[model samples]
Target: MGEFSKTVGEQGENLVSKFLDTIGWVGAQSGESIDCCKSEAHKNPGTNGRKTHGIDFFYSTKSQLQDYTLDNVVMSVKYTDKPYPSNPSTLFKAHLKDLAYTIECYMKSDFRTDNNDEHSMSGIKQANDTGVLFWFTNDKDSDQDVVGKVSTIQLEKSLSFSSIYLVDNSRAAFIYNVIKYVRDNFSEYSFYYHYTFSSANYKGADNERYGIVFPVEYLVSNILPFRLINKDTKKNVFCLASREQFSEESINRLLYLASDISQDFTDEFIFLFPEYDPLHDNKVLMKAKRLVNAKNRAPNIKVLAYNNDFRGLVNE
Candidate 1:
């Protein structure tokens, strides 16, 4: 890579690492090389047998949503100064292949063994190694949905990685916007991940209700539920983030979810969507609120739109 390319790549890695910290994957191992377990299988075309594979970041965490499961995540970050190519399939496939190989070797490497030993818990029954590729671009068309474009690319059966998530600039922007909106608007409240049936079932007394760390599943989810608490008033507010644009159907479903999980002590409920407009969407929001109210007594529901300002990521 050229000097400019290298600089851009490093900046992307830093940005992604900081973002991961907010979602509870903190203190990851960054910029490390692990021994390649399958030298011949993963050999470069014209070079000697592969000796090492470079990893951008690696983190292991106990699943907050799944009972007794551990997640070992390997990440690859690709950032560019230009928009995504007119067609991003070939390049996306190559990136996935490389990440798959990394995971295959990482699963058998000593690094994983050491990490597993250190992070082991008594009730853990399963451990999954997954890869996440964050392909981002800073340009006029940074909103391009690379993940959607590459969704149909067929992968080689030889790739051993089970699950590889693609986070294009578009998806990254959605997540960043949701977090920034919460921080900026609800400054008095602290954020927490809402516990679902899977997580609540196996939670122990010492296991904190305030979830600072999230499971790998949240990275690809369309909706994120948050439980916010005010320090002084000791009041709880339930918030749901919907990545999809605002609509009556979406708001209705979110209402049902909030109603199902909400506690009696919840002070209020808020819904966030990317394309919500107060003037235009208020009618639909009121309709959805009434629909839910007919079945269950709904709380005061506030709707807001989050800004999709991904360009700010580069500045950070």
Candidate 2:
């Protein structure tokens, strides 16, 4: 297992490096300047000695054209070897938080200077106004045919980032063109990946996302209502709880709470179950299905089996 793990890790890192090189090649072809940073200051050196930092490919332009500013293109490379778990919470929150922090710090520092002069700050300021492109790669296990996976991050949102995953090789050319567009036409917008958790939520995990505990009734009542508050929104709420905490009676009670809340605000309710073969002794899946199919259902309810490959839907 250790040897296999090492191979997986190295493969992931290699894919990320190649992706960065591709970005550099595309930037150079378009007459853009590129720099790659290798520093422990950008990475979180927690208990593990490993240090990782931002943008394996950092890019800037030599000439300005249209609204495109030459200083706005930046790219980061991330490599992950582990298989994505069935549930989002299964991934370590600390690791994700540190990654987000490193990116945030890198962006701020990339454009900051001590001189603060108009011309000097202009270059840094223009760069700050420009958005960053993040290329994320993960190596598949031996069973899978793909050598690597690629994804793009959009950093337009203030508190949250958005990402779209693409298959390897297929989108390589398109990725370069988009980077060029940001450099010349849209230097003011930042692009980032919208991971399951946001930087703020991850930083304040103990107080916000994973730390607080609520009664089963309170949890059911609040989740969908909070989602409904924004009509036309398709926000996903990821809940993590031990199956041991659920019972037929408790499940029915929670269903009742949901039904009551739905009367005030009507919306579709969909519950996703893990796709992998059953391993735990608990009957959480069975109970959840039963509750959703109950005769007293008020709002429309749909139950979906989970897909491991699906990227997270939650912005935070």
Candidate 3:
């Protein structure tokens, strides 16, 4: 991790600790929560060999506060400070898979089982409640990239829990905001918005440009309270995007909008399509005799092509 990333991680842990304290948890740690199973393992050595699980924090409720049983509640926390990947769809899929895994594990574990029923091998069917993904950040720079972007969406149709969470976070708030936004703003006219940008590339000129600025403008102009949510702390403003959008004219509209949003934002903007043959000409694909030539000069605009694998290029 970079210096900023390390600082963010530490800050995230501290914020989570504070959140737990607020909810009446006595002790909380940055890592997994394994308090419930620790003693059980000590009594049964064979249990030690099984997988270990943890909740982010463990605490006892005040006896007089309510009739709810303390053993019935388990809290799991996840921390993230990095801007979610630029690709929302892929990130949404991955997050959904993670939630499914967590649910599966919780269902199979002894963490929620009664001591007497432990031998029965039955699973608890009670609803497992999870705290919102907390976001923590000390960066107050208004020139931040995503200060006020918001998207309204609805879950009129049933979606996997993870997908639901993904939509919520994608809007830079906890799942609640996503649910609310959808409930209030969703209509037959509202279209789901998607943004795509290219990775930062060196400007042939000395402007030092990179990122997809085009769609970013659309995000800032349309979305309200443009900010990213940290499940650990809460939603806060954070810059997210690259600077490569200025390289092409066809997409320059997006770049202009992004530039209008924040002057301090600095990142390369990626184009959805890096290369394409508008004429279906095979000559464009042929090996060039020279990398650069006046006669066969490459087109200035980069379009988003269907086959352009953004992740693959980034990995390379």
Candidate 4:
């Protein structure tokens, strides 16, 4: 655990592969030479290119438009800044030994599929395996020792992860400051935002697709974006998307300012429009669908349509 903590845990696994490429995960490298050794005998994808094995990210999330499949989301990334081993089963035995050989080679691969059009990969691998443990850290000041003995249901019923996204380190800078607040307010077209590993029971704002809330006036403005990113002092914020709302009462005043800070058990809400925020002539996605059909609707206060600057939809 040296070498600058393994390069800050490999840059916190490249910010967990850019937060799983903003959410729609799509082949985010590191199968470690195609599921690296277990005594040779690996390599899929036409004998070489397929890669993807136990963890360190190996994705796929598009069941339609251009179709996709492979996504058991096995993960493992730990970047420390010292102070954590105060005996919590010694950091859960090094996180179940880095997720027992990539979940024992993804439970002896096979993921069966005779092309029966696999049911939209239901809930991204129900229990077959869906691990995640980003857990980064700028260390706000101790106390984060592997999330103070956290336990995703005893580490997913004793490993083989079916769901575990402890992305710490102030939630990796509040999802990298909401993709740098849409790459600094749109900075000129080219957009694509996603950060959902599943969860959208909508209608009550309960779409845990990468859950979020962060109130406190998004850190006194300026760049809070909606606050809730304080890894001891990592600090997070939001609330600024006024470069030109267009009209129609400024898209109902940005959907009455996001339903005046919604919260139906908080699950999703990261509003920030600028890169040419056009709400007027009714088109900014029809003013975000009239602010999700205004009048106390708060349909998870989301306003997205196209033009995302995440560059042609996350490839890095």
| Model 2 lDDT per residue over 1-316, tens place | 8887677556654664564454343332221221224344333456433243433334343212212112333343334554443332323233334344444544445332321232452332233223232223353332221212111222324322121222222233234333343233323333221122323223322222221111112211212112212223433332211111234454455456555544433445533233322334136646665656666553454333233333323200
Worst ten-residue run, lDDT, model 1? 307-316
Candidate closer to the true structure by TM-score (higher is better), 3 or 4? 3
Alpha-carbon RMSD, each predicted model: 4.1, 16.4, 20.4, 17.5
Tens-place lDDT digits, model 3, residues 228-282: 2234544222222222221234334443443444334322222232233444522
How close is every model to the real structure, measured as TM-score? 0.91, 0.30, 0.31, 0.26
Best by TM-score: 1
Q: Model 3 residue 105 lDDT?
A: 49
Please write out the lDDT profile of model 1 over residues 8-28, one tens digit for every residue.
988898889888887778798
lDDT agreement of model 4 with the native: 0.44
CA-lDDT, candidates in order: 0.81, 0.34, 0.33, 0.44
Clashes of 1: 0
User: In model 2, which runs have C-alpha deviations exceeding 4 angstroms?
Assistant: 1-10, 20-55, 62-76, 89-96, 107-125, 129-316
lDDT score for residue 47 of model 4: 59
Model 3: what TM-score?
0.31
The candidate that achieves the highest lDDT relative to the unseen native structure:
1
**Model 1 pairs whose backbones collide:** none
Order candidates by lDDT, high to low: 1, 4, 2, 3
